[model samples]
Target: MTLTLYSNYVNSAGERVRIALALKGIDYEYVSVGEISWEVYERINPQRLMPALKIGDQIVPQATAILEYLEETYPKPALLPADPVLRAQARAFAQHVVSEMHAIDVIRVRRFLHNQLGVDQEGIDHWQNHWFANGFAALEELLARRQTAWTFCFGETPGWADLHLTPQVTKGIARFNVDMAPYPLISGIHKACVTLPAFIAATPAEQPDYPGRVIEPKLR
Candidate 1:
């Protein structure tokens, strides 16, 4: 059966799936959809979200679910550890970002570009920093107490939690001007993540509609 990932080129969740695919070294077809592609995605997923995976005859939605599916179906270099507690920890970390973290998307970037969020610059700055500080505070605590050898989110490997985090780190830094110097463990984990081929292969810049010129200046 052919594995087809239907996603937008610059989506965070979509990027997660891409990393999982790369980590498992699985061959799949990439179908890039536009912002308005939600109209079509609604047919596939009632939620109308990206990063939907079509494997054989099954359709999987939700980013974290897709990652778990990938791990269960193709368990080679195992992303999730064998120990149940460790796996739970990893899943918790992933959930923290996907659920607890705020100001994680390109809201600030869009506001900067259009200046149309009805808020002043000071308000925008406060909103952005507020979320990063709150989220990283939780992340820092998790990493500081982690009992692992590889300095990953979970045991000794880059599991689902680590995969969910790396891209958000990029978004926090490039898009929200998040400084990682405060979160040493997160910084270390992100550093380790980039060294892996799967994480490298799933970078947003490598995607097709990556706002090459628009966000390039701000990225630096």
Candidate 2:
């Protein structure tokens, strides 16, 4: 089956799906939709979003939906946990990161903040920093709540939560000037994730249309 993903660098939602695709060892056609206008992207995804996955003749839009589709289709080496409760927990964590934390931390949103709301660059930076720190704080507490020690969120192995996390955290530190000091658990998991080949391959820097500086956060 030909899995064609329409994506771009700096699209956190797209990056989330990329991590899942890599984790499942799925080889896909990377079609660069970067630098496309909203009108153009709307042809692939009506929502005007990046990372629309085409499965055969059917098109799958939205990161969360695409992920669930992939998880169902690619069952082996599961991205979600086996146990039902753990699976729900993982979904909750991943969804929260994608929908809540990551939703506002996008380029368009920043553009909205600046162009529409009359916020300055410093204000935009402050806006991003505030929300990212809030998201990281919640994730830190969640990671600390469940386990004594885990290399990834929800477990030792990289799974659902890690998929959303690695992208968001990496982008956060790189672009938003997010501090990792308050999120030791999250920071540690990110460090461990970047070491893995799949996670590394799925990063924004590894994308074809990457034009920004790459982030390799200090694990110290």
lDDT (Cα atoms) of all candidates against the true structure: 0.76, 0.82
lDDT of 2 at 140: 85
Candidate 1 lDDT over 1-220, as tens digits, reads: 7998887656778888899889889999877666447677788777666778888877888888888888888988788778898778888888888877732444445366336546665676676787778888898898788775467887667778888889888778876688889888888888889888888888876666666642422311
| Candidate 1 all-Cα RMSD | 3.9
Q: Which stretches of candidate 2 lie over 4 Å from their true place?
A: 35-39, 212-220
TM per candidate comes to 0.84, 0.91
The residue-level lDDT of candidate 2 at 208 comes to: 83
lDDT by residue (tens digit), candidate 2, 4-118: 9988766778888888888888999988774566667788778767779999987988989999899899987888888888788888888778877778776778777788888
Residue ranges of candidate 1 with Cα displaced over 4 Å: 102-121, 211-220
| Model 1 poorest 10 in a row by lDDT | 211-220
